[model samples]
Target: MLPLLLVPPALSTAFALAPVRRPFAAAAAGWVVSLPALELPVHTGIGVAAVTAGALAVGPVTTADRVGTGLAALTCGGLAVVLARHRAAARVLDRAFEGFAGSGAVDTTTRTTARNRTPWPTVLLRPWPVRPRSIRARRGLVYGPDPRANRLDLYTPRDGGRPRGVLIHIHGGHFRAGGPSRESRAMLFDHALRGWASVSTTYHLSPTPEAGFPQHLVDIKRLIYWIRTEGPRHGIGADAPIVVAGSSAGAHIAMMTALTAGDPRFQPGFEEADTSLAGAIGLYGYYGRLGAETKDISDPVRHPADGAPPVAVIHGTDDMYTPVKGSRRLERHLRAGSSNPVFYAELPGAQHGFDAVQSPRYLAVVAAIARFTEPLAG
Candidate 1:
């Protein structure tokens, strides 16, 4: 019984330490393990009490069993310490930016009547775990001559009205394998519900003839230029705000593009067009690429300055794949140099790709996203 009890937690402690290797371990570590860790205070206390109760209830065991119970008890204590780190991170986030959620108010006392009002299912978690069903989406519209690598999707509100904003979501798979249809599960309809159009674009994946460093970014540039120039004809344009966002690899691209602001290298033919972004968002992302190696390279933080657009970044403290330290370093760099506002959230027990689905943590981060992006729209 003691070994059985230890197996579940001992496995998690190891995975949390070691980067995920197996597909099963990836899913469990990416999603399942963080759930309890997010609510670590509650789980840790309950676990210790439960273990004590179980040991007292089932007495008269062999000496080996007793030793096993003691080891299990020690492991449980370590697990609690691990979970406590999550709680500490959450406190750091709250202290850093608590009242700013969707209100922009620094403290509760500064909130106005409008800020006090919260939108249903927008800033708050849905009672159900599922995302709102998508409506009125246009799929696989060709944006460029490259038939295979230049397609994009637009999800619009079913009700015919001009969108309040547009979100361009770039999928992440180390620039090799992800597609528009592969990611942005929770944001698609949620943006539509809030009267915003959602754009998910596919770039030429790596290992292909057309896919290269700035070329992949150029495909995204074509999407941005298309939206800014041609979006109004389809009822999405300068009237509302436009935010470019992405996860991991996509986040890297989003940051680089937004920071460059139509640099000629990334936008070869269409260099004069206004490719400026209203805002930028990156989830569990970093400044540069190549896994913690940086220099005067093709990265965003290398070119920080005043007048850069506002950015909201979310990173998980427990994320070993990308490491949360990168996000923290970028935040410090941005704050020290950039004149624009930098909203950063470091979740306590979250892992890489944590927001693949709707959870308490995901919804809360979405609420922060709403707050950050709302002010961008003129």
Candidate 2:
């Protein structure tokens, strides 16, 4: 009974160590185990509790029972080691930001006062990321004709003060599922606290007939057009620098959006509209062309024309969905063609959807982004 009780946590630890490789099941289980694994303290507590419960429920009455309890204790201890490894993400972020110095992107010497501290209390108490009362989210703002597909949720300071900068965040689901809500709430909340208004918008998914290839990119441009023309009405100032960011597939769009600014091809009917960005950031992104059928329509590397904004690409070394090699290729491409510096943070032991939780790894990432985007806000 003791060893059996320990089986679930043990398997979760194993999966975290070596992520599930299956296509369909990996997505679901990866997120399930990834959170506690990244947020070490939470996992530690759970592991300790499991061991304690198992020991208390089944005392060492027999030789097998004693051996089972010992094995459970060892498993709990091994998980602690895994949890401790999350602290190394700070150093990873530091090395990534090292490229900013003397590159003319942002002042590398300037740093944010924000510390990369994981909210352990909140992590243990709440399963999902929390939005502070100070930040107000305005949902269901239509950015295009399709009210549901082409809508955005805007997060602004509750004080209604003019924003210093704007952040446009796109959600990722391999270009199929997912939307603006409940994604990257940690990053959104953190920036909102820094007096920046952030937009999380949705795009038409694949197989939706009306959606495919560049259609998703067009929807993002439409949202940008709406922001530039109609943002003032919503307390966003005209001078506020707008930076784009996304996770996974959304990251591909964000990079392409920055690289193809004002290009008539992507702009479509709104060709004259300025869809430029102050900068862009990609989290666990995919940079290659979607497929042979999609070609360069979804690829960020193929569209690097010039005058590219200062970009940051952060990826997990352990990401099961998107490989880190793609991000490395993007970094090299941007360095060769981009007018500004390209910051690449290759995090160790990090898995996909890292920003969904306010773990130490993600807080470090948020800090790096804050430092990178601060000078743009000025």
Q: Which one wins on lDDT?
A: 2
TM-score of each: 0.72, 0.90
174: Cα error in model 2, Å: 1.2
Off by over 4 Å in 2: 20-35, 38-41, 50-54, 57-61, 102-127, 208-211
Task: Summarize candidate 2's per-residue lDDT along 74-106 as a digit string, tens digits.
Answer: 666666666565667777777666656676566
Give candidate 1 regions above 4 Å deviation. 1-94, 98-134, 208-211, 289-297
Error of 1 at 162 (Å): 0.3
Q: Note each model's CA RMSD in angstroms.
A: 6.2, 2.8
For candidate 1, lDDT tens digit of each residue in 180-277? 85565566556777788888888888873224577777888888888887888778865467789988888877887777786787788899977788
